[model samples]
Target: MELIIAAGIIGLALGAIGAVIALRTAKSGTIREADNKVKSAHAEAEQVVSEARRTAETLKKEALLEAKEEIIKNRQAAEADDKQRKIEIHNLENRVMQREESLDRRNDALDKREHQLSSQQGNLDRRSRELEDLYQRQTAELERISDLTREDAHKELLDTVRSEVTHEAAAIIRESEQQVRAESQKTAQEIISLAIQRCASDHTAEITVTSVHIPSDDLKGRIIGREGRNIRTFEQVSGVNLVIDDTPETVVLSSFDPVRRETARVALENLIADGRIHPARIEEMYQKAASLVEQRVQEAGEQAAFDCGIHELHPELVKTLGALRYRTSFGQNVLRHSIEVAELCAIMAEELKVDARLAKRAGLLHDLGKAIDHEIEGPHAVIGADLARRHGERPVIVHAIEAHHGDIEPNTVLDVLVQAADAISASRPGARRESAENYIKRLEKLEKIANGHEGVERTYAMQAGREVHVMVQPDKISDAASTVLAHDIARQIEEEMEYPGQVRVVVIRESRATDIAK
Candidate 1:
């Protein structure tokens, strides 16, 4: 038993020893493996460091090459810039030198011109002194040749010139007068003829008494009424005179106021036609007649304005203008005459290149005073001007109205036109009538006035005393004096006599050269 226990202990001891040996060998093998791994890691670290150094060297080389190339480019650019500045400076220097040369040449030319001018000036001054000496010698020689001194000769020459100039001036004056007269006469005749030809108007003589025809003489009694009550009422209401005359069915209504006369005529006619004759009936009929006449006046005025191409006449002016319808100047109807004058003025104005419308307006209103001349106390022209001025007429128009009749001097072309038109209208053939006695007296007076002038051989009135021909003795009245004689005669006639239109005085100086060839 002891021996078996000893063997088991010995085996256990051997197994313990083997286990320790095996653990020591395993630890040594692990240490060898770790050492090999350490060597491999060290080798890899060395390769990475070497590669990093090579990459840094390559980058440094590339950067240095780029920097050197940039510096070379900058140096070349600076050289090019320096070369361009040098070329510009050279061009500027050449231009400056050329300009200096040009300035020097101009200065030399100016100096030369100045020297030439100075030389010419000295020559001119010497020549001027020589001319002065020559002129003085010539004046002395002339004065010595003539016995008279310079002052006396000059006075004699001036007197001779004055005498000759007087004759020449007279001739010139005569010639100018002839030329102006001829031209003005021709132009006036043409315009007057044209205006007359273009306008055709009818004028009838109007009397202050308007004759109203009744059915019978029996009705005249009724018109006169009981104790002339009807006639009195008519005259009072219509402001017209009722004349009951034995004129065979005609009752005369007389009034200087054409409107009143017209109203009375209408009323009388109505009373006769209606067979109603009484105070009350007369008043009513007069009222009706007045209204009718007023309407007619308005219508006539409107028509006249329309004919004249005027539309803006004041209402009162239009009415006043219409009243001219019943008025008369000479034997011509005043309204028709006014219308004719307006047309004539317009035509003449158009020919003369004046304001035709304004002329027409003035012409139409020129005779406006004639319509109320009985009521007003002045020249019709002045009254008409006042009327026009009151009605907001322009100052120029008012002036023209006032000057149409020569009551005032004409101040404008319009005034002259109205005057011409009025004269033309009044003096046209058949425009007016004069009593035979008065006509003969006027013609005789015209002839007498011409005969009364000195050197008058005979005188003849022609064209209804509108023209006078005076025969002058050739020995008494010279050729130039004949013109003066004619003017004098015309002036005398104008002052001594009143005539329509215009009068032309012609002086005939005939020199008889009688020779007998026997």
Candidate 2:
């Protein structure tokens, strides 16, 4: 029985062991199932995460493609905008070019129209001239038809016409004068007034230096100098005539050369002033005075150039110009006259709208011949012209100088203006002096001279000696004959009288025969 109990205990132990193993196996199976579920859950979570990541990637790719499409659209819009802008710019340029071409065409048309108008105006002016000539002829014919003396009819017609025309002419003149008065008066009156007022200096007389007066008779004795040695030396050296006459306190120094005369004057003045009037003193003073006079002459020439606004004169030319101070023409101081003429020329040039400086220069040189005429033996204008040409004066100015005295035909308008201005200056009132007796005698002589002409019926010297008006018979004096008569009168005047300036002779060839047709 004890063996059977041990066997049951063993069997029970075995059975317990089997049961423990079975429980352990069951716990192991539970653990394994829990691990599989956990693995499945992790796998599912991983799959969901991978799916979300793929979806996000797809959405981002779509957004990027849309952005790329938008960029392409903007780029296309920009290209289109550029193309349109180019087209607009090209159209604007074409429009501007078309407008410019139109303007050019319009300007060309205006110029053509203006030219046509000018041509038409010129034709109208020519027609007006012809009409005026026809009217004048018709009036003359009407006068001839009247049954009265031609002169009476002409006079009556003239009186009636003058009454009507005078008022019209006066109105026209007033209108025209209103427009041009300031300018015309400025030119004429202002210049004339300036010339008159400025040149109002009393005419001065110039004389040949024939005499040099001394302070006392004692000076004469001293100038004669210790048995006539000083006087002889002075006469020999200076080539002047010295007369220690009985006239109290005076000696005479005479020389043909004004330069020599001036030299002698200075020498004598020095000798007298120094109270050393001997032959030796005379020689010393003569030398010094000669030097001084030369210096003064050169200075005078330079001064003249300076005063006249002229420069660059050759030194030799200046010396010659200065020599004019000692010269005179027709009792007028030549240098003074030159200065006056220069001023007058400037005024005239300004008035007439000419070159003032050139005019003045020509005027200054106009009478330059007078300075050397004694030596040159030619007309003053010709000599002056030659001298000016030699001294490198402009050809025009030289021509003007030669033509001033009518030595040559005036080639330029300026030359004629100069001649006229010269005449005016010399012929102005109080410019030249003559006694009343001489004036009357001159008139009578002129009348006689004109009457001596073949056709001259009467003669009158008007505007002083400037104009000589002569009445000639129309039968004897043709237009050509009148010119010849004028020339002859001028020649006679030149031959008979010692006139200061030019004289004009005008021959009037007119016939007055009154016949009453009635």
Candidate 3:
């Protein structure tokens, strides 16, 4: 057992020894692998550090190049800005120098002009003094030669001029009268004769009072109505006066307006015929009568226009013209008179070679104012002229209408023709009439007007007061003065009198010289 034990110990010892050797060998090999790995790691770390250094050097070089290029760009930009500023400053200096040169030239020109003006002023002052002295010397010389002061010579010259002008004016008046009479008298007579012959219209006598025949006297009370209601309503509505009198079945309707009278007449006649007279019935009848009259007025206007050969009249104008059917002037129907005047105007216009249509139109409408003269306050001629103008008549036609009555001066040939036609129509025999008393009064007035003038010995009113003959003493009135006297008397009559048509004044002067030697 001891021997086995010793052998086991020894084997153990050897195994231990081997195990130790193996352990030492494995440790040394691990040490060598560690050393190698350490060496490789150090090498790799050095290579990465070297590459990082190279990359940092390259970035540092690029940064230095960029900084240098930025400095060059800045310097070039500064140099270019400085060059542009210098160029602008040089141009400004050139402009200033040019302005100073132009100002110097203007100043020199102004100084030259001032010197010339001063020279001209001095010359004008010298000339003015010379002229004043010359004028004084001439005035003194003229006073010495005349042997009279300036005031006395002036008065004497004025007196001579006044006397000479008076005589010259009188001579001109006489000569113009002779020339006008010789030129116009025969032509005027012929035209007037032809117009009168061509137109032969009948005259109608219309009065303000229109008589309505009632069937019996009982109608008067019915027409008057209860408590005068019917008559009052009639007057208020128709604008007419209802006059009831004991004239045997005759009730008179009176109004200054012919239209009102005519309307009232028709209404009363209708009321009497219908036999229903009350305030209501009267009013109804009045309205119907008014409408009927209005229609008649329209028709009459149309007919008058047709007769006058004027178809272009406005509707309102036609209606107004028809109103003349009920109107009258000095006992003559105004419509008939107007138609006659139109015909006369047309005939005279044809003879004078003027506008016959225009003449006829003016004459037809010349008395248009008489249609409404009672409502309006003006001369009929002016009123008619305004009416014609408002209705689109030409200015010439309006002027002719206005001037036909001598309301304004007759400036045109048409105006004269209208005047002559109006006169001829009014003054023809039986064309217009007045009471005997008024006729005698007018004749006496005509003679009295002529006798009131100077240098008149006697007066005679001829042609039913159409003309006046005045005898003047030859010793008191000269030939030229007679013509002036005739004109003055005619003008005075026109201003003072309201006679129809025109008046003729003849101032007759006879000069006689007696010889007693045989």
Candidate 1 off by > 4 Å: 1-174, 473-475, 478-480, 509-518
* Top candidate by TM-score: 1
* Candidate 2 wrongly placed segments (more than 4 Å): 1-194, 198-203, 433-441, 450-518
lDDT of 3 by residue, 335-355 (tens): 888899899989988987888
Q: Clashing residue pairs, candidate 2?
A: none
lDDT of 2 by residue, 1-518 (tens): 33444455556556555554555567665756656655555565556556555666777789899999999999999999999999999999999999999999999999999999999999999999999999888877876686566678778889888666655654565567577886685766777777657655455665675667677677777788778898899998888888888988778887667788889989988888898666777888899999999999999888887888877777777887888888765566667777777777887787778998998888878887877887878798999889989889999999999999889999886797678667766766656566689888887888889998776788889877668999988886666556556766888899898665567887887767898997
* Per-residue lDDT of candidate 1, residues 452-486 (tens digit): 88889999998888888888998877776677678
Q: What shift in Å separates residue 73 of candidate 3 from its native position after superposition?
A: 40
Superior by lDDT: candidate 1 or candidate 2: 1
Q: What RMSD, rounded to one decimal, does every model reach? A: 18.4, 21.4, 16.2
Best by lDDT: 3
For candidate 1, what is the total of clashing residue pairs? 0
Global lDDT of each model? 0.85, 0.78, 0.86
| TM-scores, one per candidate | 0.64, 0.53, 0.62
